[model samples]
Target: MEFYLFNLIRWILNIYYYILIARILMSWVPGMERTPIGGILYRLTEPYLSPFRRIIPPISFGGMGLDLSPIVAFLAYSFLEGGIFTVLRSLFHWVG
Candidate 1:
Protein backbone atom coordinates (compact mmCIF):
# COMPACT_ATOMS: atom_id res chain seq x y z
CA MET A 1 0.00 0.00 0.00
CA GLU A 2 2.78 2.41 0.83
CA PHE A 3 4.53 1.57 -2.41
CA TYR A 4 1.43 2.30 -4.41
CA LEU A 5 0.72 5.52 -2.52
CA PHE A 6 4.27 6.73 -2.90
CA ASN A 7 4.31 6.03 -6.62
CA LEU A 8 0.98 7.76 -7.07
CA ILE A 9 2.13 10.87 -5.26
CA ARG A 10 5.41 10.89 -7.17
CA TRP A 11 3.58 10.60 -10.48
CA ILE A 12 1.26 13.46 -9.65
CA LEU A 13 4.12 15.66 -8.52
CA ASN A 14 6.06 14.90 -11.70
CA ILE A 15 3.09 15.92 -13.82
CA TYR A 16 2.67 19.18 -11.94
CA TYR A 17 6.38 19.85 -12.22
CA TYR A 18 6.09 19.52 -15.98
CA ILE A 19 3.06 21.77 -15.95
CA LEU A 20 4.97 24.44 -14.07
CA ILE A 21 7.84 24.14 -16.51
CA ALA A 22 5.43 24.53 -19.43
CA ARG A 23 3.94 27.63 -17.84
CA ILE A 24 7.38 29.13 -17.32
CA LEU A 25 8.37 28.36 -20.89
CA MET A 26 5.16 29.88 -22.18
CA SER A 27 6.09 33.18 -20.56
CA TRP A 28 8.98 33.45 -22.97
CA VAL A 29 6.61 33.74 -25.92
CA PRO A 30 4.48 36.89 -26.10
CA GLY A 31 0.70 36.27 -26.13
CA MET A 32 1.27 32.58 -25.31
CA GLU A 33 -0.67 32.85 -22.08
CA ARG A 34 -3.75 33.85 -24.03
CA THR A 35 -3.78 30.52 -25.86
CA PRO A 36 -5.86 27.63 -24.56
CA ILE A 37 -2.99 25.37 -23.47
CA GLY A 38 -1.07 28.26 -21.98
CA GLY A 39 -4.15 29.45 -20.10
CA ILE A 40 -4.61 25.98 -18.63
CA LEU A 41 -0.98 25.81 -17.58
CA TYR A 42 -1.22 29.27 -16.02
CA ARG A 43 -4.32 28.36 -14.08
CA LEU A 44 -2.73 25.14 -12.84
CA THR A 45 0.59 26.69 -11.79
CA GLU A 46 -0.20 30.27 -10.76
CA PRO A 47 -1.84 29.39 -7.47
CA TYR A 48 1.26 27.49 -6.38
CA LEU A 49 3.67 30.13 -7.68
CA SER A 50 1.90 33.33 -6.59
CA PRO A 51 2.91 33.35 -2.94
CA PHE A 52 6.56 33.03 -3.88
CA ARG A 53 6.15 35.86 -6.37
CA ARG A 54 4.66 38.06 -3.70
CA ILE A 55 7.48 37.25 -1.30
CA ILE A 56 10.26 37.84 -3.82
CA PRO A 57 9.76 40.57 -6.34
CA PRO A 58 11.35 40.25 -9.77
CA ILE A 59 14.87 41.45 -10.35
CA SER A 60 15.17 44.29 -12.83
CA PHE A 61 17.91 45.17 -15.26
CA GLY A 62 17.27 48.24 -17.38
CA GLY A 63 13.62 47.86 -18.47
CA MET A 64 13.41 44.09 -18.31
CA GLY A 65 12.65 42.04 -15.21
CA LEU A 66 13.58 38.42 -14.36
CA ASP A 67 11.13 36.57 -12.18
CA LEU A 68 12.74 34.34 -9.58
CA SER A 69 9.47 32.99 -8.28
CA PRO A 70 9.64 29.88 -10.43
CA ILE A 71 13.10 29.02 -9.15
CA VAL A 72 11.91 29.45 -5.60
CA ALA A 73 8.80 27.41 -6.31
CA PHE A 74 10.92 24.60 -7.74
CA LEU A 75 13.14 24.62 -4.69
CA ALA A 76 10.13 24.51 -2.42
CA TYR A 77 8.72 21.60 -4.39
CA SER A 78 12.01 19.72 -4.13
CA PHE A 79 12.06 20.17 -0.36
CA LEU A 80 8.42 19.21 -0.01
CA GLU A 81 8.82 16.07 -2.12
CA GLY A 82 11.89 15.04 -0.19
CA GLY A 83 10.24 15.58 3.17
CA ILE A 84 7.09 13.73 2.17
CA PHE A 85 9.02 10.73 0.88
CA THR A 86 11.25 10.71 3.91
CA VAL A 87 8.27 10.50 6.23
CA LEU A 88 6.66 7.86 4.11
CA ARG A 89 9.80 5.76 4.06
CA SER A 90 10.35 5.98 7.78
CA LEU A 91 6.74 5.36 8.71
CA PHE A 92 6.04 2.54 6.28
CA HIS A 93 9.53 1.10 5.71
CA TRP A 94 8.92 1.37 2.00
CA VAL A 95 12.19 1.54 0.10
CA GLY A 96 11.90 3.26 -3.23
Candidate 2:
Protein backbone atom coordinates (compact mmCIF):
# COMPACT_ATOMS: atom_id res chain seq x y z
CA MET A 1 0.00 0.00 0.00
CA GLU A 2 2.69 2.45 0.97
CA PHE A 3 4.75 1.59 -2.09
CA TYR A 4 1.80 2.30 -4.34
CA LEU A 5 1.18 5.61 -2.64
CA PHE A 6 4.83 6.65 -2.91
CA ASN A 7 4.99 5.84 -6.61
CA LEU A 8 1.75 7.69 -7.22
CA ILE A 9 3.04 10.79 -5.47
CA ARG A 10 6.31 10.72 -7.44
CA TRP A 11 4.43 10.26 -10.71
CA ILE A 12 2.23 13.23 -10.03
CA LEU A 13 5.21 15.39 -9.16
CA ASN A 14 7.07 14.27 -12.27
CA ILE A 15 4.10 15.13 -14.48
CA TYR A 16 3.77 18.62 -13.04
CA TYR A 17 7.51 19.18 -13.26
CA TYR A 18 7.50 18.23 -16.93
CA ILE A 19 4.52 20.45 -17.60
CA LEU A 20 6.30 23.38 -16.05
CA ILE A 21 9.39 22.77 -18.16
CA ALA A 22 7.26 22.40 -21.29
CA ARG A 23 5.60 25.73 -20.60
CA ILE A 24 8.99 27.45 -20.52
CA LEU A 25 10.15 25.72 -23.69
CA MET A 26 6.93 26.57 -25.52
CA SER A 27 7.65 30.26 -25.13
CA TRP A 28 10.73 30.07 -27.35
CA VAL A 29 8.83 28.64 -30.30
CA PRO A 30 6.81 31.28 -32.10
CA GLY A 31 3.02 30.71 -32.34
CA MET A 32 3.24 27.67 -30.07
CA GLU A 33 1.21 29.38 -27.41
CA ARG A 34 -1.67 29.86 -29.85
CA THR A 35 -2.16 26.13 -30.36
CA PRO A 36 -4.76 24.19 -28.33
CA ILE A 37 -2.30 22.07 -26.40
CA GLY A 38 -0.13 25.08 -25.63
CA GLY A 39 -3.13 27.03 -24.45
CA ILE A 40 -4.15 24.24 -22.13
CA LEU A 41 -0.67 24.06 -20.67
CA TYR A 42 -0.72 27.79 -20.12
CA ARG A 43 -4.03 27.64 -18.33
CA LEU A 44 -2.88 24.80 -16.10
CA THR A 45 0.41 26.41 -15.11
CA GLU A 46 -0.66 30.03 -14.84
CA PRO A 47 -2.61 29.81 -11.61
CA TYR A 48 0.39 28.60 -9.62
CA LEU A 49 2.87 30.78 -11.53
CA SER A 50 0.92 34.02 -11.40
CA PRO A 51 1.57 34.60 -7.74
CA PHE A 52 5.31 34.19 -8.16
CA ARG A 53 5.23 36.35 -11.29
CA ARG A 54 3.64 39.09 -9.27
CA ILE A 55 6.27 38.82 -6.56
CA ILE A 56 9.24 38.58 -8.93
CA PRO A 57 8.63 40.71 -11.95
CA PRO A 58 10.81 40.17 -15.01
CA ILE A 59 14.27 41.61 -14.66
CA SER A 60 15.50 43.76 -17.48
CA PHE A 61 19.16 43.62 -18.39
CA GLY A 62 20.53 45.48 -21.39
CA GLY A 63 17.07 45.44 -23.04
CA MET A 64 16.83 41.67 -22.60
CA GLY A 65 14.17 40.39 -20.26
CA LEU A 66 14.54 37.34 -18.03
CA ASP A 67 11.51 35.84 -16.34
CA LEU A 68 12.45 34.41 -12.98
CA SER A 69 9.03 33.10 -12.07
CA PRO A 70 9.72 29.71 -13.58
CA ILE A 71 12.87 29.26 -11.54
CA VAL A 72 11.07 30.28 -8.39
CA ALA A 73 8.16 28.04 -9.27
CA PHE A 74 10.43 25.01 -9.68
CA LEU A 75 12.19 25.73 -6.41
CA ALA A 76 8.86 26.04 -4.62
CA TYR A 77 7.69 22.76 -6.09
CA SER A 78 10.89 21.06 -4.91
CA PHE A 79 10.29 22.29 -1.39
CA LEU A 80 6.70 21.05 -1.47
CA GLU A 81 7.71 17.63 -2.81
CA GLY A 82 10.44 17.30 -0.21
CA GLY A 83 8.07 18.07 2.63
CA ILE A 84 5.45 15.65 1.33
CA PHE A 85 8.02 12.87 0.91
CA THR A 86 9.39 13.47 4.39
CA VAL A 87 6.00 13.15 6.01
CA LEU A 88 5.02 10.08 4.02
CA ARG A 89 8.36 8.36 4.69
CA SER A 90 8.03 8.91 8.40
CA LEU A 91 4.51 7.52 8.36
CA PHE A 92 5.56 4.40 6.49
CA HIS A 93 8.61 3.94 8.69
CA TRP A 94 6.45 4.10 11.81
CA VAL A 95 4.01 1.58 10.41
CA GLY A 96 6.66 -0.89 9.33
Candidate 3:
Protein backbone atom coordinates (compact mmCIF):
# COMPACT_ATOMS: atom_id res chain seq x y z
CA MET A 1 0.00 0.00 0.00
CA GLU A 2 1.07 3.60 -0.54
CA PHE A 3 0.91 4.26 3.19
CA TYR A 4 3.41 1.52 3.94
CA LEU A 5 5.63 2.55 1.07
CA PHE A 6 5.71 6.13 2.26
CA ASN A 7 6.55 5.10 5.82
CA LEU A 8 9.26 2.73 4.58
CA ILE A 9 10.94 5.38 2.50
CA ARG A 10 10.65 7.88 5.32
CA TRP A 11 12.24 5.41 7.72
CA ILE A 12 15.14 4.86 5.34
CA LEU A 13 15.70 8.56 4.95
CA ASN A 14 15.61 9.06 8.71
CA ILE A 15 18.30 6.41 9.09
CA TYR A 16 20.41 8.21 6.49
CA TYR A 17 19.95 11.46 8.41
CA TYR A 18 21.26 9.80 11.54
CA ILE A 19 24.18 8.39 9.57
CA LEU A 20 25.06 11.87 8.42
CA ILE A 21 24.96 13.12 12.00
CA ALA A 22 27.21 10.30 13.11
CA ARG A 23 29.67 11.13 10.35
CA ILE A 24 29.74 14.75 11.46
CA LEU A 25 30.33 13.80 15.07
CA MET A 26 33.02 11.31 14.14
CA SER A 27 35.02 14.04 12.45
CA TRP A 28 35.70 15.65 15.80
CA VAL A 29 37.76 12.72 16.97
CA PRO A 30 41.34 12.30 15.76
CA GLY A 31 41.99 9.25 13.55
CA MET A 32 38.30 8.31 13.72
CA GLU A 33 38.22 8.08 9.95
CA ARG A 34 40.63 5.18 10.05
CA THR A 35 38.22 3.03 12.04
CA PRO A 36 35.78 0.62 10.38
CA ILE A 37 32.62 2.46 11.53
CA GLY A 38 34.09 5.75 10.42
CA GLY A 39 34.99 4.27 7.07
CA ILE A 40 31.43 3.04 6.61
CA LEU A 41 30.00 6.39 7.56
CA TYR A 42 32.42 8.15 5.21
CA ARG A 43 31.41 5.90 2.31
CA LEU A 44 27.72 6.46 2.99
CA THR A 45 27.85 10.24 3.42
CA GLU A 46 30.71 11.43 1.20
CA PRO A 47 28.87 11.13 -2.11
CA TYR A 48 25.98 13.19 -0.77
CA LEU A 49 28.36 15.79 0.72
CA SER A 50 31.15 16.06 -1.84
CA PRO A 51 29.24 18.24 -4.28
CA PHE A 52 28.42 20.70 -1.51
CA ARG A 53 32.11 20.84 -0.62
CA ARG A 54 32.94 21.65 -4.23
CA ILE A 55 30.32 24.39 -4.38
CA ILE A 56 31.30 26.01 -1.08
CA PRO A 57 34.94 26.16 -0.10
CA PRO A 58 35.88 26.07 3.58
CA ILE A 59 36.30 29.29 5.53
CA SER A 60 39.95 29.97 6.10
CA PHE A 61 41.22 31.22 9.48
CA GLY A 62 44.95 31.79 8.86
CA GLY A 63 46.11 28.15 8.50
CA MET A 64 43.12 26.16 9.85
CA GLY A 65 39.95 26.15 7.80
CA LEU A 66 36.39 25.41 8.92
CA ASP A 67 34.41 23.20 6.60
CA LEU A 68 30.82 24.29 6.19
CA SER A 69 29.84 21.61 3.71
CA PRO A 70 28.16 19.42 6.33
CA ILE A 71 25.99 22.29 7.54
CA VAL A 72 24.99 23.09 3.96
CA ALA A 73 24.40 19.41 3.29
CA PHE A 74 22.13 19.22 6.34
CA LEU A 75 20.07 22.18 5.18
CA ALA A 76 19.80 20.72 1.69
CA TYR A 77 18.78 17.35 3.09
CA SER A 78 16.04 18.94 5.17
CA PHE A 79 14.61 20.64 2.07
CA LEU A 80 14.92 17.46 0.02
CA GLU A 81 13.17 15.40 2.69
CA GLY A 82 10.38 17.93 2.93
CA GLY A 83 9.89 17.94 -0.85
CA ILE A 84 9.88 14.15 -1.09
CA PHE A 85 7.31 13.83 1.66
CA THR A 86 5.17 16.51 0.09
CA VAL A 87 5.06 14.65 -3.21
CA LEU A 88 4.45 11.35 -1.48
CA ARG A 89 1.63 12.82 0.60
CA SER A 90 -0.08 14.24 -2.47
CA LEU A 91 0.27 10.95 -4.30
CA PHE A 92 -1.16 9.03 -1.32
CA HIS A 93 -3.84 11.54 -0.45
CA TRP A 94 -2.41 11.76 3.03
CA VAL A 95 -4.30 13.99 5.42
CA GLY A 96 -1.49 14.88 7.77
Top-down TM-score ranking: 1, 3, 2
Candidate 3 pairs with clashing backbones: none
Could you give candidate 1's per-residue lDDT for residues 1-96 as a string of tens digits? 878899998999899999989999999999999999988998998899999999999999789999988998999999998998999899998787
What lDDT tens digits, residue by residue, belong to model 2 across residues 2-53? 9889989889999989998999999888899999999999998989889999
Between prediction 1 and prediction 3, which has the larger lDDT?
3
Please state the error at residue 2 of candidate 3 in Å. Answer: 1.5
Global Cα lDDT for candidate 2: 0.90
Q: Model 2: clashing residue pairs?
A: none
lDDT of 1 at 24: 92
Task: Judge candidate 2 at residue 87 and give its lDDT.
Answer: 94
Which should have the higher TM-score, number 1 or number 2? 1
Q: Once superposed on the true structure, which residue ranges of model 2 sit more than 4 Å away at CA?
A: 94-96
Q: Which scores better on lDDT, 1 or 2? A: 1
Residue-by-residue lDDT tens digits, candidate 3, 49-79? 9999999998987897889999989999999
| Candidate with better TM-score, 2 vs 3 | 3
Q: How far is each candidate from the true structure, as Cα RMSD in Å?
A: 1.0, 2.1, 1.2
**Model 1 regions lying over 4 Å from their true place:** none
